[model samples]
Target: METNRNSNIIKLKQNLKYRNILIDAFPLLGLIIIILFFTIITSGNLLTLNNLKIILNQMFLYLIGGLGSVYLYAQGGIDVSMASNIGFSAILGVRIMYQHVGIGIIATLLIGSSIGLLMGIIYAYAGIPVFIQGLAMDFLLKGTLYPLSGFKASIPVPDRLLKFDNKYFAWIFLLIIFIFIFFTYNFSRFGKECRSIGAGEIASIQSGIKVKKNKVLAFFISGLTCGIVAVYTLIRTGSASQSTGLGFNFNVMLSLVLGGCVLGGGNGVKVRNAVIGAVTFVVLQNGLVLCGASARAQDIVKGILFVLMIVFTSKMYERKV
Candidate 1:
């Protein structure tokens, strides 16, 4: 009886190991299937060089913003205002460019970081929930920018900035940011602290993780990335409008989820997830267009996929827990 019981336990462990492997592979599999399906439907137009370039261009901002958001999300924090903050930062940057291009870029980054730091402090020290704080900040920034831009439907970006739109520059910048984030997130104490906090705040605090300080730092890092991405947006569009960054936060959240980064945080977070998710997202959007799908149809498809992905990932995490 003892021997039989031991064998059954071993069989159960083997089954669990296989289950975990499948969960890990699902995102990549989904990406592959999407690409293949779209390629066939589009008559292979999806993989043409021009379309590929367009996809890459669309992906740059999402990839960077998504990376920044990873820090906040890893600690189970949400910032609904990130898109608005980017819009405000771009407006400020464009205004400064009227004086000096170099100064404009520097000023934009500084403003973004400062605002992010302030929000972090409020959430961490003032006992405000990050979600509520983010919502307030979003409204405040969007309102401030709306009036300052003369309520213009679109703020024009300077023509001089258009020279910087080369894909090579974007690739290099993205690579650097990815490498820096990858090392910091995987190798540093900061990353470990973030994971611990996300896993269990009470447990992390009892373990001497300095929860408040880390939370503030995570927001700061997220803000800094936002600052950089603001620059990317300015160059890409050469302008900022009232609707400039509208819906960006949702897109980033969707990308993170599609990449397998759990909203509950801990253990499953990875920089690669941001990269893969960004690519998949851009491809999905572009492919839908190439396949002649209507705007409403595209949105409906994306929405359904987003919810299903969330449900699937949530189950995977629950099983692991």
Candidate 2:
């Protein structure tokens, strides 16, 4: 019966392989399920063209911020200062453009990203820890927002600023931006080096990966994404507030984790995963709001779902038997 037992083992392994493929694809499946449920729950309310625009708008905003975050992921680190970065930069960029020569939108992005590049340099080369680096950036940026605004919450943002957030503009802009970055990162030597660094820094360095440069570039892009995302945020709300980026740290981190990037780093590092994860959270929140759930209840549910995602994505539970 030894030969029969061997045949059975082979079959079992094949079955298990298919099972994993499904499990791995579950997040995308879950996204579809949520959309269907959303269609049924809100019926006409959420099924309208305007509603769809709104969803796209939110997605546009979050994904831009999360894009920088994906860079951090690809580089084996994290940037928790997203909300603060966006808010402060929005306030700062607007004021600078309005008061002086109007560096315009593109220039504003450069400034925000420069700040991020500086932060990354400090972290990667100065030997500062990533966690501390993130926390410090968040605080420093947050503190800068109020003073930069001259303690004003209602900065008169130029109407010209609205162009970036316009639906068509965001659609075209985000599409080109992400696709370009995605391919550039996945296909280039720099991209390869970033993932290598994430996989194992010491090993990557030994292999001549230029770890610090890649990390700095990644952080700079992330900062630029923050600025890009902020453009949308300003459009949606029409004004930047002290609380504009109040809870971004938690939201961005949640999106990253849900996307299947491990806590410490090192994975296949896909930006598509980040997009999918952000969509999951957005759908969850939208569903809760439609169901008339309280904010507190929604928060609790989100926490529970995140935990579930962690469990599902965990490798610790692999069964050998």
Candidate 3:
């Protein structure tokens, strides 16, 4: 009886491991399926070189933001203020640019890092929930943004820097960022520490992980990324508006989720996940438009897909008894 019980337990563990492997592959599988489906439905227009360029352009910022966010999500923290942070950072960068041509870029990055560091301090040391801190920050920035811009519909980019808008520049910049993040995330101590924290904070603390420091670092990285993307957004649109970073928080979250990165973190985080998800998301949106899906219909489809993916991911990563 004892031997039989042990054998059955081993088999159960194997089955669970196999199931997890399949779940892990789902995002990539889904990406392929979605692309093929859209390609067929759009009658091959989706695969054209020009359309592919459009998809790459659309996904560039999302991929950058998503990469930065992997650190936060790995530690099981969420920041709803990132979108507002990006918007406010861009505004500050623009103001500085107006005073001195090149200094504005550095100023914007610094402001973003500062805000992220502040939030991380509050969340890690002050005992505030990261989410609440994010909400408060968002509101504060949005309130100040209106008065600072004098309620302008948008702030136009400096004509001299307009050349940055070219896709070639964008791709090179994105590639550099991606390479840096990929190395840091896969090989650095920071990645391991974050995964440990996400797996369980109490356990991480007991293991001498310096949870507070790592948490702050994660937030700072996230902020830095937001700031960089703010520059990208400003260049891409050649302007910054009240709506400049609107919906970014949602879009990044969605991209991460779609890429199979769990909200609770720890188990299945990868830099490639963000890239895959970002590309998949852009393709999905562009395909829908080509197929003439109305805005309402698109939202419905997206909502349903989001729910299904969440359910699938959650189940895949659940702890077994």
Tens-place lDDT per residue, model 1, 83-172, is 888888888878898888889889889888888888888989998888889999998998888776767877777788777778897899
When sorted by lDDT, best at the front, the candidate numbers are: 3, 1, 2
State the weakest 10-residue window (summed lDDT) of model 2: 312-321
Candidate 3 lDDT tens digits, 1-321: 999999999999999888767777888898999899999999999999999988988998889989999989989988899999998999888888788757988888988888999889889999888888899999999888876666898889788667666787778878898899888888899888898899999999998899999999999998998889888887778887778799898899999888888889885677877988898888889988989999999999889888888887777767422
Candidate that beats the other on TM-score, 1 or 3, i.e. the better one? 1
Q: Relative to the true structure, how large is the alpha-carbon lDDT of every model?
A: 0.85, 0.72, 0.86
Sequence-dependent TM-score of model 2: 0.87
lDDT of 2 by residue, 77-155 (tens): 8777777887887786767666542474665677668878887899888998887888888888877788887888667
lDDT of 1: 0.85
TM-score of each model, in listed order: 0.94, 0.87, 0.93
Q: In candidate 3, which residue pairs clash?
A: none
Backbone clash pairs in model 2 (N, Cα, C under 3 Å; residues 3+ apart or in different chains), count: 1
- Which residue runs does candidate 3 get wrong by more than 4 Å? 1-18, 319-321
- List candidate 2 stretches off by more than 4 Å: 1-20, 43-46, 99-102, 163-165, 316-321
